[model samples]
Target chain A: MICLSLFLSFLQIGLFSFGGGYAAMPLIQEQVVTLHGWLSMETFADLVTISEMTPGPIAVNAATFVGTQTAGFAGAVAATLGCVLPSCLFVTLLAFIYTRCRSLPILQQTLASLRPAVVSMIAKAGLTILISAFFLDGTASLIRENISVRMIVWFAAALFLLRKKKWNPILVMALCGICEAAFCAV
Target chain B: MEIFQKKQRLPVLLRLFTSTLYLSAFTFGGGYVIVTLLKNTFVDKYHWISEEEMLDLTAIAQSAPGAVAVNGAAAVGCRIAGIPGVLASVLGAVIPPMAILSLVSLCYTVFCSNPWISAALNGMKAGVGAVITSVVWDMSSRIVRSKDPANTLILILSFCLCWFGGVNVICIILAAAAFGVLRSLHAKKGGSAA
Candidate 1:
């Protein structure tokens, strides 16, 4: 039953995640954290961390990690399969039509419209996770005392490197970890 | 000719599988990264696909509802070897992440407990937030650049609905798509009348 739920939840995520991986983050958060209670907000943030560190789309990685966490290897397989099913099914059909007609204006318009919405979803997910990282508590409190200055500093540095220096995200992630570990050791 | 094509099919499928596997395994930061890798390998290296077709495939991949990386691969796969090709390519794309995440999940408890690891994750979590903010910034700016009032309106309204209003994202997306379709229809009618 757990495996079935994992599969179905991911199937919904896969079906609706139109923009790309990052755009799908909120939907994943909604399913795993809010709807299912499969993972807490903090663990969901950790899942994003691991997904970023790893070498795949966030949706697939999330499915595998959450599935494994909840129901072991079989669950991972089920969830991963669910996640990819939409891609396999729809892409093939679209590919066929695309090769025949060479254009899809309606599809194009829908995608154009979707771009802003996707950005909105991504922004919300980022803010939600950002709050969890900074506050370390639930989203209820908006107190200044809840903020973590170290995290804020690291976030600024990371954003600077990412935007100005064009540093690879994996490299930035690794640097963040090493620097944090070193700071803690001292 | 049919016999020759049949003989060539298995090797092409095998190559597709292995190439996508390597691409998916090595490309970090996902999405566009893997798509670029796919272009390099398929268009430039193997010469299995042409550049123009790849762009169209990318469009279809992007517009369709799924991970761009997987959709792109499946489109390329369909072009190359049809249904069997899709199967091979998707399996290739799926395996690396599944295997890697499964391994990481097994060690997650260990990851949580270790002080160094926990500290690292804390830092990485901040990094993750920064990265997401960057993505949001980049995408929003692109929409704003279009200067289309409707698109801009959609962007602002959707952001407000999702973030402040606590509306479900799925509804926002559907509404946006509907708005887009209606706007296009109106424009087309105006064009025809004019």
Candidate 2:
């Protein structure tokens, strides 16, 4: 029963999570945290953090994490499989259709339209995370007390290192963590 | 699409599995980061998929209903090797997250209670935000550089709606798709007249 529920919830997540991994955040929160009570909010936040620090897609990571926390190794396999089944099915079908229809100008144009919309979605997800990081409780307000100076500094440094210096992103992530830990120690 | 048919099926599938495994295991931020890496590995290094094909595949992957990383791997896999390719790539994409998180879950208490780790995570979050912002900057700049006024307009409008207006992403995607169909129909009508 536990594994079944885990599988079902992740299947819902995999089937309905459109756009990308970040866009699936709310749905995962709903199923795992609110609906099934598989994890508390704090643990969910930790999951997000770990997802960021670790490799692979956030949805897959979430499925595995939640499954393990709720059940065991078998649960992890079930949830992870459920999470990716829709991706394999949908993408394969889309790939088949796309290869068949790619020559059509209409199909080409439609795919073109998706580019801007998708980029905008990425921008929104970035801004949401930025706000969540720099501001308390993810409030968008820029009031004096709401901002974290340390985070802002780190954000600026990261942006410069990434865009200007063209530093390796993984290295940048490690530096950011080390610096933050040092700051907290100080 | 049949480019790999000349090659031995087993080796091709094995390479696909290992390549995606390496990419997924190392990429931390996920989504576009992994996509970018896949482009590097497949398009730039392997020369199996073309530049244009990668873009289209990415579009389909993003537009589909699932995690972009897995979808992308599956899409690329299908394109390269067929259904068997999809199995290999999807397995490669999923294995790392499951294994890593499973290990993390085994030490959940220590991980959660460590203030130092949380502090590091706090910093990493800011860095992640910046990484995402850079990706957005790179992508939108590419759109602008393409000099397509319609696409540029869509970029700005969608960003505003989702960020400020709090519009659901699904609605925006549907609206964009509808707009594309309309534009295509209009062009067809014009073509017929000419």
Candidate 3:
């Protein structure tokens, strides 16, 4: 039963989430917190923290954590496989079709329509994560309390450095994390 | 003898292995950062696909399954190479973290209450929050710039529903899908009537 739940939750995450791992957060939050009752909101938040800190996609982190919590190591494998299986299967199939229809106008039109929908899904996922992060308990305390101001400023600075100044991402993330630790201590 | 020519595919495997290492080592800010790196390597550096194709592939990858970064990498690999590419990319993405986590999990049990590690993680949490916020802003600007009122409205509603109302995201996704489909149909019907 635990295995089944892990499979289904990840499968749902795989099918519905658009725009990537961050976009899957709300769906993951819902499944882990509200539906399955496997983890608490606080734990989910903690998982998000770990997921962001660790190297890999958020979905994979969630799968590993949730699977481990529910059914040990095997559960972790089950969840990870469940999450990634869709991508593996879809890409392979799409590859086959793409080769055959690389020049078809009708296929192109269908893909065109699908683009806006994909954009919308990605947008929605972003909104969900923003809300989850900054506006907990139906309040924007993260901003109002000024707890996140410095962090935001540093994040913007990092973004500028990465985009405009062409800095490396690893350096930026490390610097930001260091700055954050310093500020919090002060 | 000519018909049985054995093509050397070792370079492809090496590329896949290296990419996997890069992903596991450098992906700290989650999926979007990985995607950006992928764009740098696959699209800009390698010229595997055009920028437009990359965006389309990203969309499809996000909507498919697994981690978006891994999925995107696999899609690009399959597109550029073949089944071998898929294996190489996925293995590249999954292996490092899996090994690291196994070690961490072992140590974590021993250090569950270590003050230094705990404090470090607490500080890291704040950084994670900041990273997530940056991801949201980056994605929103890239994907939600239409002047369409309906799109704008849906964005606002979805934010409010999830953030304030605490509505289930699965329901919100379904609602958004239905709303988009119905709106598109209505626009088509109105166009025909005119």
The lDDT leader among the candidates is: 2
Ranking by DockQ: 2, 1, 3
Q: lDDT per residue, candidate 3, B3-50, as tens digits?
A: 111364667567756866675666654554455566656665667576
Residue A43, candidate 3: alpha-carbon lDDT: 72
Candidate DockQ scores, in order: 0.42, 0.59, 0.25
State each candidate's chain A TM-score.
0.56, 0.73, 0.58
Backbone N/Cα/C clashes per model: 0, 0, 1
Candidates sorted by TM-score, descending order?
2, 1, 3
Model 2 has how many clashing residue pairs?
Answer: 0
CAPRI level of candidate 1: acceptable
Interface RMSD of each: 5.6, 2.8, 5.7
Output the better candidate (2/3) by lDDT: 2
Quick one: ranking by lDDT, best first?
2, 1, 3
Evaluate chain B of model 3: give its TM-score: 0.63
- Per-residue lDDT for B14-108 in model 1, tens only? 99999889778754554655565676578767888765566557656767788988888898998888889899999899899888888888786
Which regions of candidate 2 fall more than 4 Å away from where they truly are? Answer: A1-9, A17-59, A65-71, B2-5, B8-19, B22-33, B36-55
Q: For residue B138, what is the lDDT in candidate 1?
A: 63
